[model samples]
Target: MHTTTSDTAPEQRTAAPRHPVARAGRISAQGAAALVLVLLLLVVVRLPWAGDLGMHAATVERLRHGLLHPGNPLIDADTPSPYYSPWTLLLGIVAKLTGLSVFVVLRLGALAGLALLVTGVHRYVRTLTAHRAAPALALLSLLFLWGPALFSWSGFLGLNSLALTVSYPSVCALGLTFHFWAWLTRAARGPIGWGAGAGLGVLWAVILLCHQFTGVVATLGGLAMVAGARPARATLLRLGTGLLPGLLVLWLWPYYDFFALFSAGGDLEAVHRSLYRDLAGRFGYVLLGVVALGFRLRRDRRDPLALFFALGVLMVAAGGLTGHYSWGRALPAALIPAQLAAALQAVSAGRWALRRGWACVLLVALVAGAWTQAGTLGYVVRRDALPGAVAAKYREPWAGYQWIVRAGVRYGDVVMARRFPARQIPAYGPYTVAPGYPDVFLPDADRREAAMKRYFEAGTGDGERRAILRAYGARWVVGGAPAPWLHKTAVGPRGQVLYRVAP
Candidate 1:
């Protein structure tokens, strides 16, 4: 029988490897539980969409149609907008391919980005240490960090803000940058290839497309990675060459205008002030966590984790001073991965350095963290549970603007409104307000603001109104209270009236 089995042939002695799905199905209960925990965390962490989220959705929706590219829908519809990022382009493509509404696509896409970011951070932490608790601790640091989960002046709290509060482009950019760094870190340990170098360049370019500010942060982190590795000239050359595509994209698209806006004194001081205010309560905890982790890492200069965190902090500081609000806002996205690695190491070291009884207390603290996280998630969902809660919060009195869109206000029509800003209305209607808030940088912004002021004056006579309207070229007025001078064209769904300017 043994002879017969040997005669069967060498090939028959070994069975083909099981399909990945079959292997995956054989995962232990612990692995399965971990998977469930991750999935739950994804849902809990992603907050409801609001404000800029809606605007971004509307931008993508427009792009999906004949609009082709992104524009400030609330501003001059014809003029290019800074919203023309790789994220919007990808959202449009996904919507088209899946036949899903851009709104739905945006939500799902953001969720996917969140998932990618968490997984990338988890993998990176594991790479830093063999301690089993380190990975979970990393996640706990993120979940338990004292940050705004709903809305901040910059967006949402912590790293979640990038994916949820801010534009999806930033979220995707964060995820891409994290994955790229993770890959770069691994490749640095081995002999790198031309393919990886090219890939890094291409990835860098894509990050630029997603968000120029994020691109800057990625460059900083990537340089830190390279410095740590001290890679050969060929690798560095390839990385440099890879940036060409991104630079070309910047030249060809909205970045040219984006830089111009920032350079032209784009109310940067105000943005900087706002960013500082947001950072006050939110970032301090993250900094402390990173510091704790850094101390545990032996403060090694060559450590990639330390370098990455340091570079991230430097980039954030530079961004703040330079009036790069998005850069400053998105800096956390880059730092979170490193912060997690540090946290894991720090926590693991603490467990080892302490007595067994103290270890039990650490376990208790982790369980408490899990419980608190669940409660926090519950509070977040409950607070914004009502239908249109976010819309009511941000859109405010302009929640009725959709009626104007339904009433078929001319596309790109410039209307004067007291409540909703021009940019905010674009999410609900095809029309633009005369001169809304100074959110987006527009050419002739000073003149528009002045004209808007005159139009809203209590003593503004018909002649003055006409002159103001003529100056701003706005034909319609969306107001709450009826005006004797205005000829009512149509009543909106919410009983708000649209009036034609009587010359």
Candidate 2:
């Protein structure tokens, strides 16, 4: 009997345990407890409430109240919001099942996503390393060194500071992106079959539904995975067939919106800011990866990690040249791939150092120090906002707006305000707000912003303000000072008045 090398490879691979139960049993009690404690600390950390989170919560509220018959609940006659999201669906389900407020649900969702992301990354690192100790060390490094800068290096995207403040959809989408990569890598390695292919498509669809850009990156990474795996024609055909669901999602609604997104140019200046200054604010793990890559350690030629790393570097370069839409929406997602490669390098280094005595200790200490520094930076970013699930406690900030709502401020009623919090009144209150545009994706946003400024600060008298407001269908004025010419229906705690404007 002739035995080929391939005949014994399967047996050897099967001999290596990959099951969660098998892996869990190998975890030290102390390590498990420490992980639990760290997770708990992350959960307990204060999550701030800001306009974006509030807007998402409000949108979820609309979804929950009319789950069976849904419309764009946030849009009114004055403000047209043609927004669609799968995050709303997830939040609606949680809210319906648990009967919790959208605020609480968002917090829970963010925490869950974060936990999954950390675990998924840890598993990914373990697969890349020669020793299990490397995974543990890498996990610790991620926790301490990972700064929450969501977009560029500046912590401006609310990372470390306002990360929890962004809509849970984006955060959950990011987490989904990570898992999507992991699952795709597995399917790519397996024998091409209906199950694997269909699963890939389904996961791709889910990731797209969760967040569009993250979905695109997932798709790109999937393609890269296919290219790296270099499967047979039959396998490639099966995989293509499996990805039908994802194609269907694009065909359904995403294609139209996606086309619209690109039709309007991105913000190149924002890209420059992120690449030159902001991209370095968080994720010290990136530096570790660069240093490790410099070591020129031999990596597997077919390693998906290499492809992902190349893709990430490509993203940074491309991200810098694209407009705002690409920069804000698609580019930041490159962090997932970059982190994956960096983490692999970091873990490999740890595994290498295990043989070199105390060098590993010194390296870990450096990472720990970097984490401490990142934490300090995070504190500076988040210090202005109150913590602990702002959605649940948002009423304090919305007190003035709530008063206006209680005063019978009708739906579609437009109010003008220039203040930051004033702009948020529409999301928190029952009425619409005019000269208060929130969308950055629209092509005419610059025009609308300029028009809004003209309506507020540029106007000299009540006649000018009234004419401008009337044109946009403005019927109220929400601000710290009342428009003396208009009738004040209510005055809020901070002396903010909701004045009734006549057509």
Give the top-scoring candidate (TM-score): 1
Residue-level lDDT of model 1, residues 174-219, one tens digit each, is 6677677767655554456667766777777777767666667677
Model 1: lDDT to the true structure: 0.55
lDDT of 1 at 284: 41
- Superposed Cα deviation of residue 478, candidate 1 (Å): 2.7
Candidate 2 per-residue C-alpha lDDT over 19-112 given as tens digits, one digit per residue, 9 for 90 to 100: 4643452354227436533534453354444445556665666656666544434334322232346667767778888888666777776677
lDDT of each: 0.55, 0.51
Clashes of each: 0, 14
Give the lDDT of residue 215 in candidate 1: 69
Candidate 2 displacement at residue 287 in angstroms: 2.0
